[model samples]
Every structure is written in structure tokens, then in C-alpha cells.
Target: MGNSPRPGLWALEKSTDYGKSFKPWMYFSDSTHIKDISIGGRCMCNGHADTCDPADPNADSNILYDAGVDEKHQSLDIYGRYEGGGVCQNCQHNTEGINCNKCQPTFYRPSGKRWDEIDVCQQESGRCECRKEFNPPNCDSCAYGYFDYPNCKPCTCNLNGTEGQHCTPTDGICPCKYNYAGQSCEICEDGYYSAQCKNCNCDTSGTEPSICDDVTGQCICKLLHGGTRAGACVRALRVRPRRLDRRQLLGRRQVQLPHQLWRQAVQPPNFDSVKCDRCREQFYNYPACEECNCDPRGVVASFAGCGSVPAGELCQCKDRVQGRICNDCKPLFWNMQEYNPYGCEECRCHLAGTLGGLGACDTRSGQCECKSHVGARTCDQCRDGFYRLQGDNVFGCTRDCDKQSGQCRCHSRVEGRRCDRPIRAHYVPTLHQYQFELEDGVTQSGPVRYRNNEDTFPGYSWKGYVLFSMLQNEVINVVQIPKSSLYRLVLKYMNPLPDNVRATVIITPESVVDIQQK
Candidate 1:
């Protein structure tokens, strides 16, 4: 066929006869008579052509030369001899091809083209396989008490008598260094004990017995009770005696004793020490009798015959007197002169002005003369700011003033026997009327003005003494005292002046005359 269409770019051509049918076709070299079609640019067969020039033989050969195609794929032939399907290198079924499926069974594949070597699969056993010591089977590492090599290994005992595989056991059974006891060697030497053999008994007088090791002769003592010597028992001393009962002895009736005369059969006579007729139960001796003094303040009475005495024998005090003989006067009442039978004949204070004095009452004076405010025989007076109002009664004096006018007014606001406080302002007469004269000889009758806004006085401010009668409407002028310039304020009235008069005057410092007149 037209020198066999160039290899890779081959196409079937129509036959010369119109009735002929086509066949599955590929290209072959015309002179060599060999099929030369490539699949993926790989050469299918090895054959040479006669008409192909040596320099550029089979210019369109099936062998691809493009760098984009793989070196292995450049020689692959589509219609060449067939090779059986190959398996992946990673799989058990894989024989001779690149492992296209790189993962083992139950594993995922890795990204990349298949290669000759295969990759291992990840574990999918579903059970944990790590080997920790305390961890269960297949654990990757050993737990705390166990060490791990390829497999888990347990700890070995530290020494003999140690049972646990672990280095530390619940009870450290190894014996203590020396002189120690108990499972952990917590106690020490025989009777003495502690974490170590550090203490011993030293107290010798205590109640408990001390101990010593049988072999070493070292002192050991019981807890809290210790002694210096070994096996020495200490006893406690100083015990108190029980109380004795005495109630039964006091309840006995009259006790009697028998007198023993000389008898044919001689025998020792029993004698009772507590048989006394006069002294009763308390007195043990019989020869002397003691009297019981019932008075708490008196001395006990004892005699040769009586066992006890009653309270009547003690001396008593009379009205104003006290003591064993009832001779001294009572506290507040003092005695001045000597007196008998009646004790202090007249109870009195030390001073003349107080109560009863040394002698009888002063019938002439009626009562003792007390100093101004003082009372009684002592001359005691009322406290400061106080005065006596009634006769000799010290309780009557008061600090109040008399109620009537013209009396020394205790206070302008108060008007009573006792100036306890101010009287109501509304009750006092705030204004008063009078006659007065002026400096220019003018006269007037008016009310005088008081500093308290409520009080007023009607009068003038000139020369002369003006006499105004409160009862009769009379105003008369009298001689004025030159020194008392205020006399000028009196007045000679013009219009039968009103009953009350009031006036206002201004005085300057330089106007000595005006001020004096006011």
C-alpha cells in the first residue's frame, strides 16, 4: 500500500474493487513486511525496512521520542504480542509488575505511580496492643511497677524476707538495724519504746516497776512511769483518811457508869471517857464544866459545875448608849459631862448651837441661839445662796425673794418669796408717766422710755426736780441737785398733761450737759 502509511499515524485505505470489505488494520513497513503500530508510543515488534534510509530510517517510526511520554511507555505497542494482566507489588497476589495498589489488604492506598517496592499496611486489629505495665495484654509499654524490654517485666524484690515484687511492699518486713521491734521496726528496746532506742527509765520513786533487757542489762521503763533501777517496783504514799461519823454519839440519853468495889473474882473494869452530866455531848472531861454562851458577840462562860450558859448573862445597851456596860453614847449624840444610871444624862452635839447641850434646855432662851444661818448645837448653817425664812427651823430657809414690792427685787422678772424664775413679761407695768423740763426751760409731762421695748416712762429731759404724784394728778417743780443733772428731766407741764408721758432724746458725746440731764 503506498509504502505503508507512516507507523503511528496509520489509516485504512479503500480497495480498488468496489465490492471489497475492510479489515482491522495497522501500519507495517512495505519492504520489511512487519506490523509497526505502537500503543502509547512503544514499539510493538523489532523489524527493519529496505526502502527506509539509514540516516532517517522509518522517519515515522512507532517508537516515540517525545520527552512528555515515560521512557517505559515510549516503547509500548498497542497491537504487539500480549502480556498477561499483572498484580500490585504490595498485595499477596502481586508477581511481577510495579505495585500499582501500594497498600496491603484493609489499608488505604498512597498517592503516586506504582513502583517496584510495596508499603506496609497500618494496624487494623481493633484491639489495643500497647503494653503498659498495669495495662492489659498487648499494651505497648509497661505500667508503673513494671519495666519494659521487648516484653513487660516486673520489679524484683530488694532483698530476702521482702515478699512483694515491687521495690516497696505494704509492710517493710526487713528487720530494723538494732534494738527495734514491730513489723515496720516502729518500737524500740524491751519495756522502753519509740521509733528508735533513744529513751530510758530514770525515775526511781515512781509507782510502776522498771525493766531491763535480759541480755544487755539496759534499763527500760513502762510509759509515763520510769525508774533508774531495773525491775524495781515503786509504791505511792500519802493517802488521805476517811471521815468519821459523830451524829450517833450525840443522840444518847443520860449515860451511867458502875463503881466497882473489891470482889472475890478480880477483873479489869471498862471505863467510858464521855460520860458527863453538865456539859452534854461536846465536853469529854467531867471534872470541869464549861458553859455555852449563846450570844455571838460575847465570850464563852466556863465554870467547875455548869456545862453551858444562856444568853441573859451578857450586858446590854440602853436607849442612846451602847457597849458591854451600856456607858457610851450612840454615834451622832455625844456626851459632854459625866453622868451615871441614865448613861448620858442629856444627849447633845458638841457645839452650843446644836441639839441638847451639856446642861438642861435653855428655858429662858427657849432654844439654843444658832448663828445667822446655822442651826442645832453645832452652828451648822444653810448652804451658800440660801437664807432662813422662818424661826429656828433650819429647814425653812430658801433662796427665793419676798413677793411684795419695795423689797429688794430679787429680779426684775421675778416677784415672789422664792425667786425661782422669771415672771411672765405681760404681768409687769412696762411704762410709767412723769413730769420733766427741757434745757431751754421748756417743760413737759410724759412717759419715760425703757430699754426693753415693752416699758415706757413719760418724762422730759431738762433742768429741775419734777414731782409727779401717782395718786393725785399733780406735777410740782422742786430744787434740782446740781451734781445729779438727770434732775433736769423733771417737768413743769403745759396742758394738764396726760396721765402717761413718753419722750425721746438724742445726746452726743460732746453734749455733756444733755447726757447728764437724761
Candidate 2:
């Protein structure tokens, strides 16, 4: 039954053919006595009341409120299918859906809990309350481990080296330690001088070692010591009573010598000198003092030694000097020679086109990185539009010419540096038409042509320049076109050039083009 016409009256209705033919069920009620069902709407229930265990209000044992529940939309009963009517009144706690059997999110039954009283994962004050560390989305894992969950474990890490979010429980390997580097925190940093890289014991003494082990604090002797430490040198014993052995007659000259020295010179351990740092240059005791091979002007001198040290000393290069021997100066800086008045002077760079305008050149090869309108080492030669004059400045080109500008500057008869205007012409995107006065006072204009042989030759004009040219190649008009489009070039020569003359037609370098001639 849905609703009655009278304000507070209703009747039970029945449908004979799937709600087509209806009749009353013989019962009626006031709107206040029972829930009012709409004339055509299905019945539905309100929220389920918590009544499974009234003695324990907080305890979970709730069931659905089934009075007005829609059987078609919700479960029928507590132990029946889950999709017939609304949950019954006094439904169980932590139970959802129509039947009240499904567990709520983050809630699971403990070993001893009843079926209606499933336990919540995180409980507080006898209610399903999630802890701050773990979200309800997933109770399996947590960060900054302080407590363990059923799905997650507690983290283990040393606070000094790692703590909180830095801990990796899966790999069990600390990302990095306080002072140590590498996988296991075993090696020192690149400036492996000391523990904190604060102190360097190398070269502290007269013959101080140049390098040392970072961890062991041991001196690494230079190669001159035969890759050995200072302690590797052996001690020698002195012998007395020298005598000559088996002297040969050399023009009756007396060459007698000590017997001990004569036998030792030809026997085992024929030594010449002992390894001593104090005997070397600085005269101060050192770890390893090898003999000095340093040039007076190319090395630093401050300490002395009596032990074995490196013979190969580091050299300080002189001004404008290159190489360990200081034989040559660097590029762009001259005043070469072994000894020059000007130390190493930077090359004088001029404003105007100095050959290729390369500031300086290589000292050895005299090669320069060329610039615009300039090339060659000296930068004293003009590339184009520059006349070669007797006196050349740093720019090299003394007089401007037609090379760069293409403005011919030769005699009227020739009109171009290479006599190319009247007899020969060059084609470029900028040039559109060229008219010349003939001998008989008649003007003969070059052919009008389009660049890249565009489709506009018949009716179209590129920037107002026609595509038809009287003399082929006379007026070259190069242009910029998209690469993907086809290159269509149609040449119609209205006048033929004399056998002796030829025009220069140039296209962009490295461009691939095709001619679609009609």
C-alpha cells in the first residue's frame, strides 16, 4: 500500500499483473500510525538501531531495522541473502550492508570475538578509531615506526646515522653514514687528506710526501723512490785496508787501489751512494729524499732533507710560458722567444674585419678561429667587398669592395669586379630585375623569375616579383622555401646568352631540390 486520498488514511494494495491490475489488501492505517508509502514508490527503512546488547552500549552487536526496509532493494533477514530489505533493528557493530554480516573497513574479528562483535583494527574508547600513524585506507604499513601492526613491522635504525623516514626496513642497509661514504661506509672523501680533511701531513717536513693514504695516515712516496717508502733503504758497512788486485801493465804507469773497494766494485751490491734526504737540496730531514733534477728557475725551493725523496719535482711555469720546459708561449699571447721583453702579450683585436677577425692565433701552428669578413692567421686580408691595398691595417681590408655588399665598383664598361653585371649576372633572393642600356639607346631588362621555381610563375609572384625571366640564369632570385614541399623549377629563356658569356646561378648549399619543368 502506498498512500490514501484522505490526509491520514491509507490502504494495502495488490497488483494482479505485475502492477497492471490492482486491488486493496483489505487493510488501512493513518499516516501517523505507520510509515506512509508513496502511491507508486517502493518501501524503504531508516538507519538500523543499535540494540543487540543494550547492557553494553559501546559494544558492537548491531542488527538492521527491518520495519520499513525495501525487500526488493535490501537483504531479507540477518542470515539470508544480502540484497532484499534494509538491515534489521539492533544490528551488530562493525557490520555493514543489508544483512549486517560484512565487516567494516579497518575492522576484523579477533580470535575470541562473537560473529556480531567483529573487532576494529585500531580501537580507542571501545570504538573503531584509527591511530594517527596508520590510515584507514591501509592498515598494513606505517611510517616512522614507533609501534608494530599486523601487516607492518617496526623499523630498526641508529638515530645518529639514520632515523624515522630515512629507515629502510626492506633492504636493511642504511643509505649513508655520518662521516663515511660508499656502500658500507668504509672509504674517505676525495680530498682524502685527513679524517675531517682539515689537516694534510703531506709535505709538512723538509722532504714531505706529496700524497698520502687517507685512512692509514701513511705517506705515499713519489715515483722517484722506485715506488718504495723511505724505510726501504739498506745500510752499508765500511771496510779497511785497501789494496790493488791483479794490476795490469798500462805503459808502466802505477794504478794501484784499495783491495776492499776493488773486490766490492766487481762483486755483489756494488753501490755508489746511499739514499739520504739530508744530502738533497733543502738540507732538512725528510721521509724520502731523492736526488734533485729541478731547474733553478722552474721549481719552488723552501725545505731540506737527508732521507730518500722524489727526484721529479713539480715546476712553476714562467709568464707567457707553456710546457714543463717553458719553451713556448700560449696562443693569442705572443712575445715568444726563450726570453722576450713583453711577457706574454694578448693579441691586438681590431674592430673592423681583420681577415677573419679571430682575436689571436695559435703560437705553434699560427692557426686562427676565423670570424666574419676575415680569415687567415694574421687577419690582414679582406674576404670580400674589400680592396687589397698596399698598406693594410689590423682589419686587413683597406678599401671596401663589392664582395659583401654585391654593389659592383668596377669601370662602367665592366660594372663588376669580375665584369659580371653586363656580361654575367648572379642570382639571389634580393634581386628582382636588372635593366641595362644597350649600344643603340634601347633598354634590355633581364628576365623576371621566381625563387625555387614556385608554382606562381604563370600567375603568382613572390613578394611581387614575377616568375618569368627573359634570359635564363641572368637574374638569379634564390628564396627560402619549406623543406617538405616539392621543388618545382620552370625555366623559360626569352633571350639566349652569347657563347662567350655565362651567368652564375647559385642555390643554398646542402639543399636538395628537384626541377618539375613543364
Give per-model TM-scores.
0.15, 0.21
lDDT of 2 by residue, 260-305 (tens): 4422211112223353313334432233333333333322233232
For model 2, what is the alpha-carbon lDDT of residue 234? 26
Candidate topping lDDT: 2
Q: What digit string (tens of lDDT, one per residue) describes model 1 on residues 185-301?
A: 444545453223443453434323434543223344344543354322222223232443333121011112233222122111122232323334443233333233222222212
Steric clash count of candidate 1: 52
Candidate 2 Cα outliers beyond 4 Å, as residue runs = 1-318, 322-325, 328-331, 342-345, 349-358, 365-367, 384-413, 420-518
TM-score of 2: 0.21
Report residue 441 deviation for candidate 1 (angstroms). Answer: 51
TM-score of model 1 (CA atoms): 0.15
lDDT of each: 0.36, 0.41
